[model samples]
Target chain A: MSSTLTVADVERIAALAQLELTAEEKQLFTKQLADILDYAEQLQAVDTSGVPATAHVLGEPVERDDAERPSLAIDEAVGNAPDPASAPGLFRVPRVIG
Target chain B: MLQSTASAIREDVASGRVSAVEVCRAFLDRTTAVNAALNAFNLVTSERALAQAAEIDRRRAAGQTLGVLAGVPVAIKDNLCVRGMTTTASSRILEHFVPPYDATVVARLAAADAVVIGKTNCDEFAMGSSNENSAFGPVRNPWAQDRTPGGSSGGSAAAVAARCAPLALGSDTGGSIRQPAGFCGVVGLKPTYGRVSRYGLLAFASSLDQIGPFTHTVRDAALALSAIAGADPSDATASREAVPDFAASLTGDIKGLRIGVPRAFVADGVDAGVRAAFDAAIGTLRGSGAQLVDIELPHARYAIPVYYLVATAEASSNLARYDGVRYGYRSARDKDQNLKQMYSRTRDEGFGAEVKRRIMLGTYVLSAGYYDAYYLKAQQVRTLVRQDYQQAFEKVDVIAMPTSPIPPFRLGERTGDPLQMYLADVFTVSANLAGLPAISVPCGFSEGHLPVGLQLTGRMFDEATLLRAADAYERETDWHAQAPAI
Candidate 1:
């Protein structure tokens, strides 16, 4: 829990998060993240032998009827697409299957 | 009209003393006049607001009954979408993205006849403790331009404090609303989790996120909450619990009410002026027939640590949709680049430094080997934090403390260090972790005339008691009546 964060660790996390970081950003994050994690290391001392984790304060997962209902219109849903004009009623993204 | 409460404005508009359009114009004019100095609003929807106001006026002329919040102007934090309005979460990624639907809360406000005047600026994706992280620029404190109106709901708080609007909406995730409300000298309330729907609010940390209000008075905060609380079909997590008439609950009577005080926890690391004001507020409460009982929240000291881990993890997952595939900013394509490269490039270009840092931290904490160490441990500790509150509430109806440990800091003072900025939310994060209702009211001012806030955390789904206690305090003092010179 007191592990030291390194530049390589940050690079790995950045890749996992799909974010491209500059050399300066990587260096800065390495120091800052290490300090923050160091501060968070205090949590490791709290003994939890049989305590259950709390994901949410809600009592139970709520369910709704699985039936047809009004939903977002295709044009309205795609209104904010980066390239909405490229294809009618669809969001155009860079070719992925190629 | 600018200085009037939402209740007063509604009465005036309803009785034909003033048209709803006039009330809208009064707030819009005040927003335009002060926004240049405060940078409170990112986009002022003059056309939409005027249209809404005109509809309210027409209904009045047609002999129809007005809603609870009839003709009151309200500013919204930019993260909550408004149909056809560009809802930027104070980030470049969504800078030009216009939603095709209104947030449930927004629709509810409209149903209550409250005019939405504008979208206020905030921390990008509501991440920073200071509003300086906004792509639109920082919102200055109305009391002092050099200091921050504590963020990420800083703009909404500043707007209400500056009298740009009688009421405003803000989202609280780790003190975004209450901290700023304290800094701006206004009444800010974060209802219990699921009390308000999160259907259209740009998700930050799903479990911790809750939408609330910033108003000039506790009664007005109660009014705004009544307009927006309850179950929503669009949001599954919305509580099925009954929505009480929050404004009607404010009888300004807290006789023999049990108040919990965690004196040891708040004794250290507090500014002298802020501590003094807090003590004075406690004394006032005691003098007003409220009984104070000492309580201990030992696990609360770790709230900041648990919050950062829990919130960032959820944010990383929630923000993963911004891959430039469907909406928002997309990076320029290169003939040789692959789809994966486009995602990294777009995210790198679109997100701010704080957002990226949190994303990276979240990814790290949830990664393979570190999951149990950071993320799981945080969840376990979160249970402790919640249990601490449950036990405390068994003995006392509400727990009281200073909303913020110190007076407002300068805009650029804590921006350089993210940890330092996070430490500022020390006193306000536990309520969110515990999923309880909390309110921040103007307690007193510092030697420099900067405002201080006294926070009250109440039982789950018990905002009625919270508002009652705060309203009672307001009747005993005139702190909420003191506005900034601006």
Candidate 2:
């Protein structure tokens, strides 16, 4: 029941992931990813009919008192920013809109 | 002194048998001597390590009692941030990005007076089973330089096996800690999920990722775990449960302990040598008062596929933050490109082949058409896997299994095949998926002289029993005593 992934599928997947793959990557991934996915099709054979999905094993959210605490200083938070230090103390990015 | 365990190192340092600085220097010298062959450490923080050691010595001179891990040399996996150190996750993306803070575990180790020697290598973003996926380089197995030390914690395990560091920190998302330890013939333990804080561990899979220790002995693992395992105000996921004295449980008496041996773990495709070693280890457990109980983990067979779906999905989202703007590697190709092109180019250039595969697969599974069919189904199967553990634990105190179905393979054997590499983790991922504490301790050696490890997984938050059982086996067997002639 498992067919190979097409070149078009790799392109669409790469685009969705915001990745720019070379032509070699496209061809290689189409086969490799398809093989992995086909192998993963083994899970479908098992009946998980009414099993509840486990988003987290603990399932219960940890409750903590919401209290004010010290946080990372602004400079520390943006210390590794690629942009130059700015007066607004924020990392500058490419202009979003004209 | 070269083969000293972490616990012994701490005691010797505190008792004035050796100065902390000298202890650190000895390991640092050993690291410099052998790291070229092992390639275990990505960056040896010699200056920082000496500084920390000097402080410990000063305190000891002032007659102040030391912490348990005081003066023990530790190598942290590159994934954990140490303030101002280039805490690259062995990926090109963060090759130069330094965090401004220490991880919760790092801070704890510092407070405990442990000396951190350096950062060890790992798979790019902790994505692969073999160390070959590392952007820096594969950590050659100390046992056989031609073979890969199992990974993505290969560097940590290799450093310990090579005696570059007596204790090292590794993060386990899907057996990154245990598999490599299994391959390297050392002790590694992944605490129950939320047992240890995850604040500074570069996220591979948030829910599944756990910081653990690689040590020469089970008692050393217990000591290291004690130093780092506790609740942190910064990490809400860390459990507030009072940590038991893990070392105290190593009484070498596990009389009447029930250890479940899951047939699924020893099923077909496991190497003959590994299976033989596993059966012999089970026999040793029987000799040491641990009762063998046959058990069924019906849905555990789906662990590999489920882990890939869940961990990659988490990776896809967690790694999306590394765009061109704020931090991490932004490609020079982004110079004149638009915002969209900048993001694509930076990621495309930053991530290695395996990391890109996971990201793309993660993005695909989480996309509109496949989310329900793949990701959701995997999560549902994850529930079944957890249930299987829950039911099995009802009848046994711990589950004993082979750590890896195969021994260490040649460095490039599985590089071209992702599925085969993923299967290397088949026996180890179920513990991660179920959020249980598991330890891999040297059990026996294969015919090739490569090491094999026995895995013992305990109930949630029951690390004491797991460590005690492992220590009992270590006491009864000389496997842990044998080190590879590096």
Candidate 3:
């Protein structure tokens, strides 16, 4: 069956998901997440021994010839950025630490 | 005019009886008056809408041939991009993000000469059952002010129910379209997965997500679907399935058709009044020359858990693109922090509780040690659920059940309990899991006057039979005719 998650588990999950939750959030998630997992425990009882996963239900991917095509302009792509006029006309972000 | 269906409006405009500009103005005025109380729309593009309407009128005046949905007013759920319009997906992160190009569906509406009035509200990233999870705010039910319009397409359903627009587009990943349509007493269609192109729709559970329409009548829903459903090169998954004349098939003839009702959906957990209405609808269908048969979808009981696992896993991967560096919300508190800190803080502040919770659950389930147990196992069960559907379909034309087990609950009733909210989707998630087309049509109302929907799940790309059955039932009853006092 499904295992109950701890507050420490929630903390680790939040970090892995790149989210910073407050203390109350951590506590709330600890309980709620465990409850959901427990509720989902019904799936554990089903025997899916020989069943294959559904990648695409009814259709197959189209084989389009990857030829040269027109694409979005550079300005239109970055027009919605928070800071569009950064040094190299690229998305500006805080520097990654070494 | 407000009571007229989109089909009726289309005919009137095409015949030059009512100008497109006049129809646009009426809808805009009605939206302005009702939107404040309903909280249905997040943006009303009045100037742009009127201008488009004027162009349609000008074209009509020039004796130009018109398309099917010539001048009907439509509302778009905020998740679908409509070039130059703010497509927020009801999340704070993309609150200011505007697309420079329109989604395939949005462009399809324009090609059909339909006027888009505004963008409707939704749950943040279309992640919740109740619209209360929206970062902007909750979209109130038009039927009952205290009740919720079932979400993430709550605003679209509300807009249609409130008569602010004759048609609106909604996306269904896990009952987002059908549940809200049931709550708001409207027709919501979740087209077969890949039947409609997902090119510019903001991704949410990509494997399960499909765009459909909400309308007052089944015919209108079919019209909207026909206008938008087709293959697109941008969406590689879009099927080259021949687009049938769905509206023509809604001839209200369901004689000798076999309708299956899963015995599992009729078990405990369904609201008493809802079950009664569902039974009554089945009886009505029986009286209309349709044979009702009991079907067994034994593994269908696991649809909810499987849907949660599959949907959350896909959502985690689909939503990972929203970092602070790009077009969406960035943390103002990121000045002195590192890049990772900025990403964390921006997402933490930008996304709502439900979104963050789903993301976390998804990440955890797909994590190394748990992937096989939760994610892969769920996929296997998903196959079983789909097999159940395939086996049942071999003996039946369409499967009928209650769209939502319960009617619209109070606004904050299940918001505090996410699992309870998840359970609300038990009856509707199987369609997404199986990649089948399903439609929720107004069947009856409960003692509390809340609308209940009878859902019909059809085989893949066989929405024709579903629409025919829904239209036949609608013709026999006045449920679709009954509107709220608001």
TM-score of each: 0.99, 0.98, 0.98
Better of 1 and 3 by lDDT: 1
Best by lDDT: 1
In model 1, the runs with Cα more than 4 Å from the true position are A1-3, B333-335
What would the per-residue lDDT of candidate 2 be over residues B214-251, giving only the tens digit for each residue? 99899999988998999888787888889888898899
What DockQ does predicted model 3 obtain? 0.77
Estimate the lDDT of model 3.
Answer: 0.91
- RMSD, one per candidate, in order: 1.0, 1.3, 1.1
Predictions' DockQ, in order:
0.77, 0.69, 0.77
Looking only at chain B, model 2 earns a TM-score of: 0.99
Write one digit per residue (lDDT tens) for candidate 3, span B348-466. Answer: 99988998989988998999899988899899998888989999999999999999999999998988888888988989999999999999999999978999999999999999999
Residue B238 of candidate 3: its Cα lDDT? 88
N/CA/C clash count, model 1: 0
List the candidate 2 regions with Cα displacement exceeding 4 Å: A1-4, A85-88
Clash pairs for candidate 3? none
TM-score of chain A of each: 0.89, 0.84, 0.86
| Candidate 1 lDDT by residue in tens digits, B1-486 | 688999999999999999999999989999999999999999999998999899999999999999999999999999999998899999999999999899999999999999999999999999988899998899999999999999999999999999999999999999999999999999999999999999999999999999999998999999889889989888889998999888899887788999999988998999999999999998898888899999999999999999999999999999999998789998885656678888999999999999999998889899999999999999999999999999999999999999999999997998888998888899988899999999999999997999999999999999999999999999999888888998
